[model samples]
Target: MARESFKIFYAGRNDVILYEGVEEVLESLKQKYVLGVITNGNADTKKIGIDHYFDFNISASDINAGKPEPIIFEEALRQSGFRAEEICHVGDHPVNDVEGSSDFGMKSIWFNEKELDWPLDQKPNFKEVNSWSELERTVESF
Candidate 1:
């Protein structure tokens, strides 16, 4: 899992902090980047106020082909005028996030919030991150 790759800080904590600075961040990257999200989750990211974070969103409800299929990710790329190699995907699930993204030549970051152990068949081209703060740092540094 996560601890195997990224450094884990804490054991378990679920403190949610919605980004109030989302608008600023989006505005900063809006023109230079093509922002979109492809997720297998059921929630509508737009309705949840994350719409500003991404220019487009492809959810399980929107795509019949779910994670591991590459359809959702492909759809997002197609809509965003991006090539797979230039795209970056972040997800906690190894198969869904890493494998799916990697299969399509997109770089992935394993968002391993839960510190666990897992052996991969191939070296995933990613950096595993443990917490949202770590994730934020990674994103900001990008």
Candidate 2:
């Protein structure tokens, strides 16, 4: 009963809250590049009402691997049909998103909305953006 109830409640992802400027940023970026989502969570862009902006959505659950793992990144590269160096991954996690994509040979942009200092010992090979407004510029600079 609990499992079913949970599934029912989460069916539409109605509780998913996007940060400010998410739509605007997505709209802007969509105009210039091929947009896709690579997520470890069950965020359905369609359910979240943003599916039209993305060309594809790759989920960790679908492939039995998560970020920081090469498999997930590999899957994204395969789906994108773009060379690793030609792609740029934007995410908030210092290790999983930033380091993972960078190590996979893709350009990375750290969405540091909280302005937190980087927690890793190694210097970041990725660029950092604190606001959605900064995102497009950062990605373009890559």
lDDT (Cα) of model 2: 0.89
Native-structure RMSD, model 2: 1.7
- Badly placed stretches (over 4 Å) of model 2 are 8-14
**Residue 127's C-alpha lDDT in candidate 1?**
72
Count of clashing residue pairs in every prediction: 2, 0
lDDT of 2 by residue, 6-89 (tens): 898778555578889889999999999988899888867887889999988998999999998999999888888998999999
Per-residue lDDT over 1-142 for candidate 1, one digit per residue giving the tens place of the 0 to 100 score: 7874332322111123455554665566665666777777655555455577677888767778888786787787888888888887778888888888889888787877678665577766777887655654565454
Off by over 4 Å in 1: 1-32, 136-142
Backbone clash pairs for candidate 1 read 1-117, 1-118
TM-score (all chains, Cα) for each model: 0.71, 0.92
What would the TM-score be for candidate 2 when compared with the true structure? 0.92
